[model samples]
Target: MKTSIIIADDHPLILKGLNDFLLEKKYNVLASAVNGKEAFELIETHNPEIAILDIQMPFLTGLDIAKKCKELNWKTKIILITFEKDENIYNEAKNLGVYGYVLKEFALAEIEHCIDSVIKAMPYFSPELLSYLEVEETPKKLELLTPTELDILKLIAQNKTAKEIGELMFISNRTVEKHKSHIIKKLDLAPIQNSLLIWVKENQKHLE
Candidate 1:
């Protein structure tokens, strides 16, 4: 039998596009909703095997509906679609036992695979989202650095040479190099040539 699915998004175009795509794939789309309340209502009525929902919606968000489904002990699996790459939201979705998390930018390309994973009772999260989360977390890792390391990192970000940094800090070039090594170790950066300078250039904003 074809899989039964419910899809919801506040944006009409997104709703239409997703609904059309799913229909084209020959899945039985039980309903499409423009808001979270309507989507949850449809879910309750149709009892579909899967629900693909937008994270932001009027009345209730996708996470809200997922929470409700968990509370009701429903068998329906949820696949959330959103533009947000927020760590807190992602963690909350995991805590709610959400089956899939997809980014809107890649939704059309990824939804089919996401649904397949859901059918197999496996969790799926967008690779782009995961990469974004990793980049976002890199800043937080700066907390592992000491004040001296942070100052050195800031100087490195400013394109300072080891001799220049040493002169500015009243330290020797060797001490500056040692500090750079310590900074690299604390940040868990690769030991490749100019790797520290490359990292500083890429993450300069975090130094501020």
Candidate 2:
């Protein structure tokens, strides 16, 4: 039997596009909704195997609907589409048991694959989103460095030597080296030639 699906989005273009694509793929598109409330009603009435929802909408958000479905113990699997790459929202979706998360920029390209994974009872998150989360972790890891270590790291990013940094900060070369070592351990950076320098260079933006 063809899979039953309902797609919802506040944007007419997205709603129509996704509905049309799924129909063309020969899936049974039961309905399309323009808001979370209407989308929830469709799910309650039709109980489709899949619900493709925009993460942000009027009345209630996609995460809100997902929470409702979980509360009702419904079998409808949710695939959230959004432009947000926020860590908190992503974590909430995972906690709500959302089956798929596709960035709006890549929705049309990734929807088919996301649907397939959900049907197989597997969760799918955008690969781009994962990469973004990995990059985001660098800023958090940097928080482990003390003020002195952070100052030295920033200087290193600017291509300053330990001696130069010590002069600027009114510290001894030995003290600067000690701070560098502490930063390396705190950040869990690999022990290798200029690893600290490499890390500082790579994460220069976060220093700003």
lDDT (0 to 1) per candidate? 0.86, 0.85
Clashes within 3 Å, all models in order:
0, 0
* Best model per lDDT: 1
Candidate 2 Cα misplacement greater than 4 A, ranges: 135-208
lDDT of 2 by residue, 1-208 (tens): 5789998999999888888888888999999999999999999999999999999999989999999998899999999999999989987876677888899999889999889977866567888987787633358888787887888888887768788999999999999988888888988865533456545644777887
Each prediction's TM-score versus the true structure: 0.65, 0.65
**Candidate 1 lDDT over residue span 159-182, tens digit each:** 677888899999999999998888
Q: In model 1, what are the clashing residue pairs, if there are any?
A: none
lDDT of 2: 0.85
Model 2 Cα displacement at 56 (Å)? 0.5
